[model samples]
Target: MIGGGAAAGTIVASADPSLPDRSAAELLVDLQNAKVDGLSGTIVQSADLGLPKIAGLTADSGGADLVNLVAGSNTARVWYAGEDKARLALMGTLGETDVIRNGDDVWFWQSKAKTATHLTLPADAEGKKPAALPTGVPSTPQDAAEQALDAIDPTTEVSTTGAAKVAGRDAYELVLSPRASESLIGQVRLAIDAEKKIPLRVDVYGKNAVNPAIRVAFQQISFDTPDAQQFTFNPPPGTKVNESTAGKLEAELDKEHKAAESSKPAPAGAEQPTVIGEGWASVVTAKLPKASGDEAKQLDGVIDMLPKVSGSWGSGHLFSGSLFSVLVTDDGRVFAGAVAPETLYKAAAK
Candidate 1:
């Protein structure tokens, strides 16, 4: 069961008893055609990824981004002005971190570190362009909804579940659930703004949990266009400024991905994952760095700090949250997914 504290963050949904009913087909059409000229909002992100408490192991560690999804709540002020301009100011106890994009330029400013990273997007060739612009931060729900809508297939079942209110806006509930029994995901629910036709909130549930494991929603939103000045930034006088181009970054990532896929030992980077099943309960396995005696001991020390679990598949550490679970085996391998731990064991045994 989810704790009361975390449950409080969920949208307190209530049925619109007096509102007229809308068909699922009509709602889907609105979602596909949804567009907003400009908007700003306060987004609340909360997660309960079933992780154990380890001292010094925080949401901002090596897996900070993923950790934050299940262990803590973060608030950010987001502004969007079309596809080419946007800003996100992440509010935190330390200070604010801001990401801003205007046309081909992007700036990431860390207030506590007093640093600014500037990046420029590569220009398209005469006949070619990148599939999408490098926004450099998570996209708005409306943007993400487009991709999620496109992913509908035989593996998923889509339907509507009445109406809800999110951030004070009336919304229709759209639910997508996997058809396969092996999937860990119970359902993905999206609250679509009835008038705006954009997602106002998203909730993800696991098979074993009644509450959403992950929730991202607007606490407050405005439809009026934000001032153009919001998209511009300048580093303070003594702040450290670094510069790079998007093309170079993309090339480096591609190189790293290929290295991860190779069976040979890889340097420190994200390991490429291989799928072991289909649908929701699929296990994703990734190659781990090969370690010697001393290196293995050092790695174990780090792993020991995380929650420990052992079973027929062998001993290793488990890092889990509500929507996802990761198992790092002793023999240099890692398996993970949004499913239960037993599912991972099956992959490890194989």
Candidate 2:
């Protein structure tokens, strides 16, 4: 039930029965426009659901060298040329892979098995999903319409609230309410940039409970084309590869993850984690984890990138004041404390 509005910006509107079509060229250009030649920045993100937050520094050479992407305790190195024919090793997660994306085919080299498996997108797609992130950028006008439909509940309508400035960009704000009383997202509002056709902020509120809100800002955007190599990854030797085609493996992985989560017990002294803001007020006690070399390093990097850190007051002032974070395991576990970060370091320490 996420509803949004468009500010009075340079948005091309159509009333004719014959709506406009978005050519592949337009999409490609949009992709290029959103790309930056070289970018090295930190991204900090969290959900009211209290998933382990993301904190780290990433450096890339436009589309040629992914150079490095360091996320808590894990790092990936990618290199590519042309349309990104290269290698990647996710030390902790997927091991390594050799990927080659020639115009005719996209393949992944499994390090563990020493083989290449081709990729095919779902049947319901126009072109290879654009080699770019779909976030922020709007799809075709029809795509926007589909998005609008998806945003609206069968029992709700979208109402334009007003306008506001987000991330220094002008945006239109809108509210979403259900026509019927029975609905989940009681009230949701969002801001969309009128010029770039991107989302600037999202806020969810409810009278019955705490509401969850997430805001985003963009910077240093470019229309410059990324070297095609950014999409490619290769595996180093002695790595095992598992080929997954038709999404079967993905589905299995998800189910397995759910099962693993259900089987986990509370840490030695903690209770179950809580979901705040939208539903509950005060949650159960938090758990802390053992921190070590890579994990500690990742935590340090992530801490540096914190946009706003909450649940802490240092000498009556705060630096990571805006973002809230809790350490959680891969199975969706959580941990927090007053000296939480320090405790985490000692726990994960070797």
Against the hidden true structure, what lDDT does model 1 obtain? 0.72
Residue 311 CA displacement from its true place in model 2, Å: 37
TM-score of each: 0.77, 0.36
Using lDDT, give the best candidate's number.
Answer: 1
Model 1 C-alpha lDDT per residue in residues 303-348, reported as the tens digit of each score: 8776678888898888876667889987778998867778888889
Question: What is the Cα-based lDDT of residue 9 in candidate 1?
Answer: 15
The CA lDDT at 17 in model 1 is 70
Writing each residue's lDDT as its tens digit, candidate 2 over 1-350 gives 22233112222322123423232223223322532232211121212322233322232223111212111122233333323233232332333433444443456664545665665544542234323211222122123333433545334445555455654556555454544332233555555544554444555444243644232223222223445656544544654545554366468779999997666653455554543321111122244443567866786555545443223322111121112223433322443332223332232221
What is the lDDT, from 0 to 100, of the residue 157 in candidate 2?
45
**Candidate 1 clashing pairs, residues 3+ apart or interchain:** 47-70, 49-70, 49-321, 49-322, 50-321, 182-281, 183-280, 183-281
**Each candidate structure's count of clashing pairs:** 8, 37
What is the alpha-carbon lDDT of model 2 when measured against the actual structure?
A: 0.37
Give the lDDT of residue 291 in candidate 1.
Answer: 67
